[model samples]
Target: MRIIFAGTPAFAVPSLRAAHAHGEVAAVYTQPDRPAGRGRGLQASPVKLEAVARGIPVLQPESLRRRSAQQALRDLAPDLMIVVAYGLILPQAVLDIPQYGCWNVHASLLPRWRGAAPIQRAIEAGDAETGVCLMQMEAGLDTGPVLLARATPIGAGETGGQLHDRLAELGAAVLADGLGLLRAGIRPVARPQPEQGATYAHKLDKAEARLDWSQPADALARKVRAFDPWPVAEAVVAGERLRIHGAVAVEEMHGAEPGTLLRAGREGLDVACGRGVLRLRVIQREGGKAITAADFLNARRDLVRA
Candidate 1:
């Protein structure tokens, strides 16, 4: 079967590989290269880089809504299309082009976290479990029936970066499963998402990374985990602004006001919160690399409690 794969980011690379391995990847659709990094040079998406390395044809269309773009995809005469983390919205006209329709490998379970930034949102929400869903594409935003799914438990201290890697691999595995069934002349059953329990995961904003000490320590800790490897949680500790790379909630009562520096010891830099304490394990000062809290204390002797 001839397949067309569409994706853009690093998270979609594994699934692109799976699709290429499963069938003939006649073409790859990804967003146009955008200026990135300090030098502001045009950089190709991770999916485009992989496709080029494999000698697959790559199409960087600004939008599929354009008739010319849609016609270009139609010219491929693809039997099926697989989209994973493809940033552009697919119009119903484009969705109807493929014989088998388009399949989307989404990061979160259907009906919940069904928007951009699902992976991080799940962690930020303190969800106990999250998973990937292979859904039949529709015009709506991730409001399609689930074809296949794989669930995994969220570790107590798993950061967004860690869970992202795991889920990327899991998404590829699920896509492979569906492809195997298709090759055997079988189609997976599509189950509609329930009417309730739907939650939209809005895109992440750098402004949201500011840690609010007035909130419960546990929530702040979750935010620290969710925002790591991106807009890391930032807070002012003893009048020094620092990025929080790792932290944990400590259930201890401290009469000090929220955001107060409670203690700086070998274990961590403990800060009083509204309900509990937040023990910061790793931190980074402005224009500095991340360092252990102990090392940070060594530089600022004033914060180290005797």
Candidate 2:
């Protein structure tokens, strides 16, 4: 099969590499380079750099809705188009170009998380389990028919970053399996998703990262995990923004008002919440480096806010 691989982020790199190794990847389509970091240097996406290293033809189309871009993709004569985190919607016209049609490697099971930011949304919702789905492409937003899926349990204390890496590997494996089934003349069955239990995974925003200590300790703990490694859960202390990276809910400790400092001890900074205490384990102060809670406490001995 002459495959056209489309994706942009690091999570999509695995599937792109897998397809290039197992199938005939004629061209790679990724988002165009963007300015990154303090220096604002233009940086190619991870998938783009990887595809180029292997000498694959790369396409950085700003919009596939344009006729020229769609024609360019059709020109590749791709038997199948594999898309993973491409960061753009595919119009119906482009979906019809490939002989075998287009297939998408989505991070979450269909219908449950149909929009962008599925992985982070699953964690934010405190879902017990989430999985990857390989679906036949369509015009709607992740409204495609499912071809293959593999389930995995979401650990009790798992962070978004941790689940992301696991799902990436699972997605690659399922993508390979899906291609094999299609090649072997196996017709995939598409099941319409149930109307109930559907949720949208909205893209993460900096505003949502602000910590609300008024909420229960358990919920706050989960928020820290869900937003970790991006828009980290934060709060202002002494007029300084503090990023909370690691914490656990202490059900036994209860009393003071939410957001109050119950104690600043060697073990951990025990912060009061609505229902219980949150033991801050790791934190990063604004303009400072991330460090253990103990180190932060040691550096500022009179920091306890009673």
Candidate 3:
């Protein structure tokens, strides 16, 4: 089968490898290179780099909505199209060109967390478990019938980056299973997502990373986990802004106002929340590397409780 793989970012790299291993990857479609890093030099997408390394043709069109772009994809004569975290939207014209239609490797279970930033949203929502779904592409955003799926539990202390890496591998494994079935001339059955329990995961904004101490400590802790390793949760603690890399909710009764520094000890920096206390384990100051709570306490002797 001639496969056309479309994806961007590191999360899609594993799936791209799986598709290439399964069948003939005629070409790869990814967003155009964009300026990145402090120097702002052009950086190619991870999928594009991998495709080039494998001697596969790479297509980086601004949009597939254009007739010329759709025609170019049609010219590839691909038997199937596999999309994983591909930034561009696929039009109906492009979807119809493939013989087996387009298959999307989404990071979350169907009808739940369906949209951009599913991985982060799942963590932020304090979900107990999240998984990947291989879905048949449609015009709507992530509203597709699932062809294959794999579920995994969300660890209590897992950060967004950790879950992302695990889900990326799981997605590749699920896609490989579907591709194996196809290679044996068997088509996987598509199951339409149920209307109930559908939640849209809007893209992550830097503004949401600001930790609100007035909210429940558990919620703030979840946000810290979810945002760790783009925005890293930020909050003003003792009149100084710090990025929270690791935190946990403590069920301690506190009369102090929210965001008040309750204690600083070898364990962690405990701050009063609306309902509980938040113990920050790892933190980083502006233009500094992440440090443990002990190190942070040592640096700020003033925060140590008498």
TM-score of each: 0.99, 0.96, 0.99
Best by lDDT: 1
Candidate 1 has its poorest 10 consecutive residues by lDDT at 297-306
lDDT of each: 0.94, 0.87, 0.94
Off by over 4 Å in 3: none
Local accuracy of candidate 3 as per-residue lDDT tens digits, 92-131: 9888999999999999998999999999999999999999
**What shift in Å separates residue 249 of candidate 1 from its native position after superposition?**
0.2
lDDT by residue for model 1 (179-279), tens: 99999999999999996999999999999999999999999999999999988999999898999999999999878889999889978999999999999
Clash pairs, model 3 backbone: none
lDDT of 3 at 138: 95
